[model samples]
Target: MRVTPQPVRRQVEERLREAIITSRFMPGEHLSDRMLGDVFGVSRGVIREAVRLLEAEGLIKVVPNRGPFVAFLSAAEATQVYEVRAVLEALAGQGFAERASTEEIAELREVFEELAATRPGTDRMVLLNLKRRFYGVMLRGCRNAYVARMLDQLLNRNSQLRATTLSDPKRLPQTIAEIRRIVEAIERRDPGAAWAACREHVHQAAQVALRILNQQARDEAAQGLEVALD
Candidate 1:
């Protein structure tokens, strides 16, 4: 039996999980216990516990006799997840618009202001964190626990797909603008406008992901043909 601190294991696991979701660790990349332990300065047992947590979250896979690898979503699965997320977030946006107070709306607006003012040189992790906070504020306006939980799960999954889309220069400005529109609608207490903005935003993101997937498939096919010719 390997001895390790539970807190260290939990922290390392959470950080690694975020890295995987952000594509810092690409899909199908092997996660070696020793390597991760060294990187995190933790015991192998701690790494194991952390890996187990990520596996439970469905963000990583631990195969029997094989190894742990970053999880990948199939094309169909990706589409399904995004579709469900669109509906869930739209509902949450509507609920937030309906229930948010003036102070709450002001707080969200402040967050948007900060997001907008941030420099372009900001890192992906920082941008991702800001995005999470922005949605978190909106979700808090939704008073229902069940809806909040479901929305959180959907968005958590979305962070994985979001990394690829972030590679596009056009997506950043477009996303910021779309989020600004949602914030504006929420501030106005217009549930219809807020819902519309949220749905349209998510649909646009899904379109971006589909485009990336198509490009990836094309690249793979080209590589395969080149290998066959050689």
Candidate 2:
């Protein structure tokens, strides 16, 4: 049987969504409908439909008169996202440790090994993809549909924030150590330890991300004040 082709609008949406998540489309950058239509070789209507889909996913925003722009995560939004992610990841870790088969655990370990082997100065995208693969194994082995679904919903936004958090050279070694702890706990089939390790990793990442977001907000505020004084 022949497979059905995906709709043009959906294809465009996925391409744009990946671009946004990978930071090829920076937050707050304007997205021109005509330009996108030309780039994607699609009609303006198709571009509009793709933009609407991304907007619903919180990856794009359409202003009344200014057209569409990539969505930016405010500090408050980032904090809430991380808070939810921490709890969900802990649940996933617990489920994976308690229920995953020996083969599944081995699979997760294999992915973790790849992630650990990534050099400290590896390309950001390469590291991010490895991390995604590691998490994919855990999510699949967790055997909780809701946990997987919730995490999936947060992934794009997580990538958006991660561009900042993962840029700090110091965070690479710390992140690897944290992930190693989680993998070690899972290897022992210790659900409680796995849950704790996963939660702690998210917590530390949230702290670093929040610090950068807060500083950026302060700098923007200062710039606005200077403009007002002028």
Candidate 3:
């Protein structure tokens, strides 16, 4: 059986999405359709489609007379994202613990091991991709379509902040430990433990990420003040 090729439109969209998530495009920076088309070697129409998709996903925003720009997230806004994601992911964890087959659990463990092995110096995109792979297994095995969909959306928004969050030397080890607890809980087939671990991991990440975001915000504000006064 021949596998169907992925659509070019989706391909362009995914590339653009990854670029934004990895901070190749800084937050609040203008996005020119012609520039993106040239960069991606795609047509303006394809770039527009990709931009529209990102805009719908909340990763990009289109303003009247301003075209498109990367969406900027404040720490307070990111907290809302983390809060919603934590609850949904905890539910997914509980479902996975109760419902995943042995094979699925093994697959999840394999992904977890790979994620655990990633060094602190790993490329941000590579680390985030591995994390997404781990969650892809868990979300599928959980067998809850709605929860999976909701959590995936939130994760997309969270990825930019998370990549920045991981740049802090203190976060990587703690992140790995929190994930270890999640894996162990799932292995024990304890829904409560799985939920607890998942929740704790998400909240811990939120705290670390928020600290980074707040500092960046303050720094930007100070720079803006200095520029205005000059």
Ranking by lDDT: 3, 2, 1
**Candidate 3: tens digits of C-alpha lDDT, residues 1-230:** 99998898999999998888778898999999888988899889989998998999999989989899999888888989999989999999999999999999999999888877877788877778788888999999999999999998889887888886665567888888888898899999999999999999999999988988889989989999999999
Q: Residue 151 of candidate 1: its Cα lDDT?
A: 78
lDDT of 1: 0.82
Residue lDDT tens for model 1, 4-31: 7667767897789777767778888999
Clashing pairs counted in every model: 0, 0, 0
Q: Flag regions of model 3 displaced more than 4 Å.
A: none
Q: Model 3 misses residue 66 by how many Å?
A: 1.9
TM-score of 2: 0.92
TM-score per candidate, in order? Answer: 0.86, 0.92, 0.93
- Of candidates 3 and 1, the better by lDDT: 3
Specify the highest-TM-score model's number: 3
What's the lDDT for candidate 3?
A: 0.89
User: Which residue ranges in model 2 land beyond 4 Å of their true spot?
Assistant: none
Cα error, residue 107 of model 1, in Å, equals 1.7
Q: Which 10 successive residues of model 2 have the least lDDT summed?
A: 160-169
